[model samples]
Target: MNRRELREQIFMLLFRVEFNQKDDMPEQCTLFLEDGDTEISEKDAAYIRSKYEKIAEKLPEIDKLINETAIGWDTQRMGKVELTIIRLAVYEIRFDETVPTGVAINEAVELAKKFGQEGSSGFVNGILAKFA
Candidate 1:
């Protein structure tokens, strides 16, 4: 899988964090990789799991940043899809130096377009622009 595909998988896994109990995430992540339609190689699967774990570790900090940057928007009140996209983008922007900030923001916008509501792209762009 390409980097974009990996990112989408990571995002999907991260999205589950909102709904699943923390204890179940490990099992859920494993199932997600094993039960997918497209077969991900072991190497790529490891990469996805590692990134997801890192992002999950930093979620409190990530949500804090989102709480601070998003004017008039509480992290808990934000749409789940938008929040997940923002969390992934924030991780890329702040923790993953390999990903350029612009690319991270652009990719978040794309993810928002795919999984978020109609205005989600613009909303995500607006929030992420604070970091830019």
Candidate 2:
């Protein structure tokens, strides 16, 4: 898979965290890879898992940043899909040096357009742009 495809997979995997318990995520992640609609290379799967875990590990910090940046729109009140996209973008912006801030924001906007409500992309771009 290409970088965008792998990021999509990582987004999908990270999306699962909002629904499943911590204890169930290991199995869920495995099932997500094994039962996905498209086949990904083992290396790609490993990359997705690692990036997902890294983002998961930093969720508290991520949310804190969002909470501070977004005024009244605390994470608990944000739409789940929007929050997930924001989390992924925040990780790329703050933790992953390889991703330029502009690319991260753009990708998050793309993900929001794909998976979120009609206005979600605008909301995502507004929030992420503050970081850039």
Candidate 3:
């Protein structure tokens, strides 16, 4: 699937993890890919799932950085979707060497536009730029 579709899957997976606190991400992902509404290939589903799980695993450190980097805001004050998007972008920027840092932050901005509150895209972009 394309990058936008992949990002949607990532957002769904992270949203699920945040709200449900599910631990069996691989199994959950397999079920979601097989049964959910999104149209994506098996390989792409696996990639998104892996990305979500990896980010979840490093959430503490990631959220810590997000909390520190967010100048006037705290992690708890941020909406869950925005926080999750930031975590995913930060993971890609810091750990996933295959994706350039600029792309990672831009992707997060796009996601914020799609899923965040009005003006949140700018907020997300501004925070991510610090890491870029």
- Which residue pairs clash in candidate 2? none
Q: Candidate 1 — what's its lDDT?
A: 0.95
Clashing pairs in 3: none
lDDT (tens digit, per residue) of candidate 2 on 1-132: 888888899999999999999999999999999898989889988899899889988999999999999976889999999999999999999999999999999999999999999999999999998888
Between prediction 1 and prediction 2, the one with superior lDDT is 1
Worst 10 residues of 3 by lDDT: 17-26
Q: Clashing residue pairs, candidate 1?
A: none
State the lDDT at 82 in candidate 1.
Answer: 96
* Per-residue alpha-carbon lDDT of candidate 1 for residues 1-132, written as tens digits (9 for 90 to 100): 898999999999899999999999999999999997779999999999999999999999999999999999978899999999999999999999999999999999999999999999999999999998
lDDT of each: 0.95, 0.92, 0.83
TM-score of every prediction relative to native: 0.98, 0.97, 0.89
Off by over 4 Å in 2: none
Candidate 2 global CA lDDT score: 0.92
Instruction: Give the alpha carbon lDDT tens digit for every residue of 13-76 in model 3.
Output: 8877766645666677777888888677768877887787788888889888988888998788
